[model samples]
Target: MCFLAESKINRIVFLSTVTDSFPKRHKGPSLTSPQRPTMRLASGHVAVQLHGEELTKIQKDFKGFGKGLVRLTPGGWLLPAPYTKFADKIYNTEFRASDVVIMTYPKCGTTWTQEVVWTMRNNPNFNHPKAGIPVKARSPFVDSDMLAHLGKDVLNSELLELVKDIVPHPDPDEGLALQLTANIPDPRTIKTHLPFSLMTPNLLDTAKVIYVARNPKDVVLSFHHHSRLMKSMSYVGSLDQYVDYFINDQLIYGPYWEHLREAWPRRDHPNMHFVFYEDMKADPMAELRKLNQFLGTDLTEEQLEKIAHYTSFEEMKRRDDFYREKEMQRLDQEVSKKDGGFFRKGEAGSWKGHLTDTQEAKINAWTKDNSQKLGITFRYSL
Candidate 1:
């Protein structure tokens, strides 16, 4: 079967880590009716029924971390099991001339770049209501739930309703990238964490792609915090252990060096533009102007200034809070009052505080060695 068609098959069952601690001898009570009960893997969560071989296959394909399992795709990338099928589907999707793809490894400056690019592309007037609506809705992550949830809550907010004319809201029911492109208007802005090799060839050929790179030390630190924040991939491992996994390329969507090495040669591709996260942090306005030139958005100096102000780290954090609060209310989930919200510290070199001297040296050596192997050079710090 074609990979795309195979992706539609729901053969794999995903059971959360909470289900893994059931007593060995106790098969547990059935989940359904007294007469015809179904055996459950755990309490509270629904049981996933799978054949013996299917269960074996899933176990073989997934690597366990603390309390979560990261599914390993045939291509060797790790992802949450629920998203593996979606990731496979993304590789088969096509792209358009007007599409702008923000590609990066996770926890890089993906959200920041998304904000900058979306603002430059859509809000040329510099007066779009910058509050309430989530940045995910503005520039949907095409391979994730962001596309389906793009405008689901916009109609609830009168403030967001004003920019419906500016930002094309995608249908909530539309989950596939192909369907999303068909429905949403031109100049579609999308985000993805897939490495360059995994992305669709047509997308690379047609759409303009903005590749964002971050110092690996910062990427590892930010990713550790992010993993703990996300429920699906809850990680309780030590920073040392995490760094080991990071160095060994065992973390989800990592092997960071290889992801960069593959993308660096293509930096000069007509449709690909490389932007460093630290550079954006150093001077966002200059980066925005360069991005504007690349995208052909041609925003005036006044508009650029306005966009720079509104999308500044502080402003974006405030907006993110508004969006997160709304989501908490909508989902009826308790919010964790943590220091690292979605938009964590936007400073460069913050990794120095978190990484040990040994860890820093290891990262530096690995980065230097890999860059040389790939015939590319990178500045380690801002």
Candidate 2:
């Protein structure tokens, strides 16, 4: 769909290599039994499934992407069949300069941050219609669960629509359009669902990065709901299991405090910006103003108002792009709602009531360890 500059892409590739050892390989995908296969992608190319019947692998093509199979998620593979090599095929060949990378741990406010950055780059008007193109393709998350567990048929439809929606004209060679977008020379913002360690090699060194984080207590609740909607993660151990996972460092991008700690020092580094979800939720206009200022742009009151209101949780909930993502098809029709949403009720205190007293105490202790050392306290809790 959209593209990141070549230099940024190069950095992402380098970093991905640094972190590339393959996390714990999952048991084969769980395509049968009660759980079905959900297919995600290699930049909207590969099919990431849990165990399921071997459906005929379809040749889904994007302009510059290589032919990739729909395999499975990064950290999970319930299928008994071999998957690492298969996943490697897609990941190894696909990520290029054109993909705008949005890297963050799960539940760390990635979706919201991606939307903000995408709007900053692509939706200059701030008042443009949301119907013209699919937001995901324009700014996609490569590792999104939607791309991971949805069926191939559904994934194909979304991919087709995303392609048509973003470029309108399709090149017979899938990689052509992407290459063109990459070579076009303007900055393109692509979102990623990958953690910092899993990002492409060359992205950070050359391109700008904005990392969004939330307090771990809220992240746990947020991730819990997110896991419920994502079938692959639905059966992930137990609440207690997850809580321990959170503390002992078992969750995806675990050691939540550590990830932030590593990134905290760079909060004020010229190319990178660190944002807290609570801060934005509390004063969206102020956040937007600051973000715009970072990008070397200023907004008229009307423009600022447009951006702020449109991205507001209340407003984003009504938009199809924000709520009904075509890619997140594996989520249960009923339970997904219970987990809140892409734009869950945006408040800092949601954790106050939900997080157990023990959990709160642990988070307090965790924050104390580095909140001041890493400048996290100054990063904005909103």
Candidate 3:
């Protein structure tokens, strides 16, 4: 099913299948309100006016459903239970030849990498002193249900205006990624947390994918804090309980081992590149150089240094309001009601402070087992 929205001369299209299942109710805007603009597509899918600030409360309510509300699809992958219907549409989405996909397991420096890549792609000469746009808007999340739910006309009108000169492709109703790709010009930046198994069949052949991996221990700690912060999926359990879920591969987009293993073998593929979060954190400049080389951007030493300066953890945090104001607003509201922001202590080995000796041992053993089993090695401490 597809949703068509009129915004100026551009037509925003959202494609999603109809499903009887809906997320559990919470204290937020009603999806069935008659006053809001609504459309029923030929595929029996219904689109509603659930974009912009209106979704903030609904997102919080959805997060309250907790980790137990995951959806295990027939494709043998897990997704946020509430977003399964959206994921269903993304799973079948198409790919474009000029796409640059940012692939990662959740909380594995997805945002940081995105900033670096987008800057490199659009501002190679460093002529643009400021980003002048949010990172999320610049590189839209391909599998984002928010984008799918809100439609391009609403969520990306600002972004579309920013790059309209560069993106002249025709529109299609395939999915968010395709829609964005069609509008954006060549070498479009796209992000996703989908495991390789669930990705488009021709993605490796058609697009350049930067896959980032991090130590599961750190990923767990960051993810725990992130989960708690995002009201839609906050966890009320102890760190021990959360680690149990991590060790057992029950977290969203987990089986970390399986996800990593599936993609590890494809690392040598010409169009694919694998990066370790630790390496990027350890020497961001070196990683940036590597990225510039891989992405075929002719950035000079000065340009590279400038990119590093702007995208550093401190700078990104300082400029969060500029790059991620909407997300920050949601998280800030969450913090007021709860307590956490998307950009928590961006450090490696942060897990050491939170994990007990026994818990550390458990994570270590699990990591060792999985690393050996998958024929991959990870630097647990930086």
TM-score for all models, in order of appearance: 0.72, 0.65, 0.73
Candidate 1 lDDT, 249-269, residue by residue in tens = 656675576678657888998
lDDT of 2 at 289: 84
List candidate 1 segments past 4 Å from native.
Answer: 1-75, 128-132, 145-182, 329-338
Q: Residue 30: error of model 2 in Å?
A: 26
Which candidate's lDDT is highest? 3
| Tens-digit lDDT string for candidate 3 (216-286) | 88999998877676544545667787887677655657667777876899999989989999999899999
* Candidate 1 Cα RMSD (Å): 10.3
Please list the C-alpha lDDT of all candidates, in the order they appear: 0.61, 0.50, 0.65
TM-score of candidate 2 versus the correct structure, residues matched by position: 0.65
lDDT of 3 at 198: 66
lDDT, candidate 2, 135-218, per-residue tens:
555564434422333333233445444465455564422332232233322455655434443344445555677778777777
Off by over 4 Å in 3: 1-63, 66-76, 128-130, 146-182, 322-329, 332-340
Clashes by residue pair, model 3:
63-231, 63-232, 63-233, 167-185
